[model samples]
Target: MAFLVDITSHLNHLNAQLQGRDQTVSDLFAHMNAFQRKLVLFKEGFSFSHPNLAHFPACEEMRRDVPECNKTFHKYRADIETLQEQFKNRFQDFYAMQPQIALFTDPLSATVSEQPPELQLELCELQSDPFFQAKGNERGILFWRLLPESRFPLLRDFALSMASMFGSTYICESNFSTMKHIKSKERNRLTDETLFHLMQIGCTNIDIDIQSIVHLQERPQVSH
Candidate 1:
């Protein structure tokens, strides 16, 4: 149970990182890379029971079987590698345009020695600046919000693209969960318009004005 909880928490953390508004493709890759490493280790050693398996005939046979434990392990490793490659290929254009974006994504990187000369000069200034140096617990591109666009033009565009990309369907999933509760059998007769308004109001952070909500009688009539 404890192991399951820990694994769930780690996955939830990864999901949270991916679903951020400021998350970049690079950020997604980095998180996935680290997570994949952990998964590889888990695949290699994790077991249903016991820390290490003693040499048993069944365990030995299972290891040899193509459709059993060995096959599952190989499949997982292959899948991770394939997915990583696919992401790299898909975003190759962005990377080709701005190789320096990778350096800008890392808050801890102190130098841009590998970056092109033009990007190097701008980043070197930011590298030592106290503001960029102060990113402690900040996630995604929120810290980059302070940097001027002129200084990091390539990074600005890259960050904007990342922010625009949808990392997950968590919002949609949450909407479905909300609908499941609201549209129970007893409330099956609720109109689609009413449900839309209910869902919109429930999901938003801003307060809705009572007076702003038009009554059914006051609503604009729609003639077919």
Candidate 2:
């Protein structure tokens, strides 16, 4: 799972680095690159190859778009789309182990009978998946809300509070990444306490900024 997290971050980094323009979508045949090529050759060894398992759908569409792409490399590049689709389905199955979060229906979102459906069905599928019933905890893209179906109200409340406060473990990883980027290994070594302080400061600043923005967005200024 940590490997998946790093792969996601690195893929985003690679995408930004490879495409200098604001509106370009070029998939990194990253493993095919000289540096990572050797590592990517064997999918089972390292995590850098994980991105190859998650190529975008748009990349496949490009095959029909570009009539001239007849080379072997072009065909291999198209594998990205297949890999991405596979990743989504595989990931869903893996996350399905979370315990059920039974909640009363709000009926706010559109019903299946409605003209335009909303995420109500998706939520239904989410809660129904065996993933939640099997495991007590589940993680998704951003937050990991505690499922409310369990009998322990205190446990549910604590989990909800932590999920709301932390949102995702991504923020924690971001702090760790920042710590790494801040100082080179060759430089003077810092004590664990110092690094701890840095992460504490970073989290504090982020919390304040997020709260301020949320508060500002909640209130609209009226013209006098």
Candidate 3:
């Protein structure tokens, strides 16, 4: 139970880190990579002979009460190994795009010669430009958006494509929750068109102009 608690705590921490809005692919990948490294540390810590429970506080507490706790270390190590494999398999596509991601995230430092022939000249020019070099510290999306379309069209387009990608299913899941609430048993009779309009209002962040809308409505004539 202690092992389960410790493992689940780590998993929950990772899941929390991966959530939220406006997260770019590179940002999410960075979190995943960090977790993968931590998994390696976890596997190492679970060695049978000399267990290192520094990260597993719950297990560490259990060890204080049960002297033979180290005997179960191998089982925990096996579970960690299995999890590590699963992560590797699940994010293989991300691993394959590492080079492109690096280029998109840090174009100034990317190897110009190694890039596609069409982009090589633009990359060299971009890297040499003092203006862009100064703005290199900005977020990847902003940095790419700032690039002159006439000068770095290909590179900017590539960066924009990468930036536009959804890092996780958070947005979709949130929208689904909103839809479910909107189409609940109480409002089950809502037509598709009505539901669509309601969803638009519910999901959008744009503020509706209530006063302007009220004024737009025709008022009835008053008799003296």
Candidate 4:
């Protein structure tokens, strides 16, 4: 997997970074073990949660003994077991908190009026809702329609912020590329304010009317 390759490639650097922070090699190894465990758990969670990914063969390829995967099972077996145990404990914790979660979603429905909301419940409810159920399948915004912004302002804002979050640097990189074109070597003296507006106009999808602006003023004559 790419994650496995990335962690392995940076293992020395990661160890060095940990050492600089006054952490020992043993601690670093433990963290690395935890990281691997978390990675597997994350993959399993994705496969289990996402309907489209449920049937994805690649999601379960790590468990296979294929040449391309070439995963070292013995190296990770102990850590994997530990991670699974932690996952089970976490699941149990959530199961124990279901009553509190239900109280949070519909506070009036709670047996005890003073019960607090559960973070896990809110998130679980968000994902389980029919509107949001299909979102991760191919990316949809039906959840927006179902959200009661005025009624649940905190939940609404949280969902909207998460929805707007960029999962990768593609947009940032594209903007930088656009800036290089807009503020070229020939126009290197452009101010930050000028560059910003120029990039905004160049990068955005909004329409601009050059003719309308031209018609607002007389054209200047060039001297021969």
Candidate 5:
């Protein structure tokens, strides 16, 4: 139970990191790569000869009471291996697009030879430019957008396509949740048109102009 709790806690943390807005495929891939590396470290930590529970506080706590906790290390190691396999299999598509992802994330370091023939010259020029070299520090979608469309049309378009790729269903799921909240049983009478506008207002960051709207409305006139 302690082992399960520790593993679940780590998984939950990764899930939370994967959530949120403005996250491009590159950002999600970076998080996944980091988590995969952590899983490797975790597998090593579960070694029978030298158990390392630094990251697994629950397991460490149980070890204090039960020194024979190392008995479960083999099972834990197997589970970690399974997890590693699952992650690799699940993100195989991402692995296949790694070259494109690398180009989008770090054009400065990307190999010009690996890129498409049309993009090769543009990529070379972009990499050699001192102005872009300094600006290359910016990451993900924004970095791709920073490229001048007129200068590096092919490279910029390719990078933008990769950068625009959907990394997760977080935004879609969040919108569904917001929609559910807006059309709750208490507000079941809301029409589709009203609901649409309400959802737009609810999901958007734009501030409503209440005072201006109130002033524009026709007020009831008082009779003397």
Candidate 6:
């Protein structure tokens, strides 16, 4: 819902901006339509002067972008449909588990009136969670906790939440690379405590002396 709402809000802002920009954008739109007609005529093997082919960058760019835009729209719509299907399933399961969780949590005080309506529904879902049911071996690291995202339905659903968002794993890999840099052959002879301290300092954005932390008492301090 937030994703859809944000997209709608931004689109409204864009429409409003264009409305106040006089007829500049409107004239460009009209010109583009004319350009498209010319391109279609060219594609039909009609003869055109050399000047026509020379300035087709705008036309060429539009040609390339149109197919990509269609693909992007299809993917966005498909994702929305998939989310709706999953939410519908989770919504039903949430209500069905209400009685069970209420019984387990408390019987006489189990009525919906005793709790916030949405919270009661969410608590019921988490308590009877298929993911948090403590079969860690069957699941994995992701299913180990539920309180972290009690508002969400299942661990699978929470994991799928950012499935479409992509990012570089460089930061994770950089931690390993930095640790290796600190533990070079010349500086390899160190206690476990010292090695751990050095690795931690190297991986973080902060620039501090690992030896100073490990040997704090021995270091000289300036008089305040």
Best by the lDDT measure: 3
Under the 3 Å rule for N, CA and C atoms, how many clashes does model 2 have?
Answer: 6
List model 3 lDDT by residue over 1-224, tens digit each: 99899999999999998898778899999999999999999999887586899999998898898879767776788899999999999999899888788888899898777677888888889899999889978868878878889988898878878988998999889988999999999878888998898788788889997567666768822210
Q: Which stretches of model 2 miss by more than 4 angstroms?
A: 1-85, 94-173, 181-189, 206-224
lDDT (tens digit, per residue) of candidate 4 on 21-76:
22322333345555555557544544322222222345345445454433333343
lDDT of 4: 0.49
lDDT of 6 at 191: 70
Poorest 10 consecutive residues by lDDT, candidate 3: 215-224
Which order, best to worst by lDDT? Answer: 3, 5, 1, 4, 6, 2
Model 6 lDDT, full chain set: 0.43
| Candidate lDDT values, in order | 0.59, 0.39, 0.86, 0.49, 0.85, 0.43
Candidate 4 minimal-lDDT segment of 10 residues: 47-56
Model 5 gets an lDDT of: 0.85
Assess the local accuracy of residue 36 in candidate 1 as a C-alpha lDDT between 0 and 100: 63
Q: How do the residues 1-224 of candidate 1 rate in per-residue lDDT, one tens digit apiece?
A: 33334445666877777773335566666776676666555545434333222323343345556334543433333544554566567656655644444554674473567765655666667667777677644555676677689877865665576566554676577778888888889888889998888788777778877454544446644420
Q: Model 5 over residues 44-129: C-alpha lDDT tens digits?
A: 98875758999999988888898887676657898999999999999999898888888878889989888778899998888898
Score every model by TM-score.
0.45, 0.29, 0.82, 0.36, 0.81, 0.26
Q: What are the runs in model 4 whose C-alpha is more than 4 Å off?
A: 1-139, 145-148, 207-224
* lDDT per residue (tens digit) for residues 38-114 in model 2: 22442322223222333333423443566343232233434435554565564352233222211211212213343
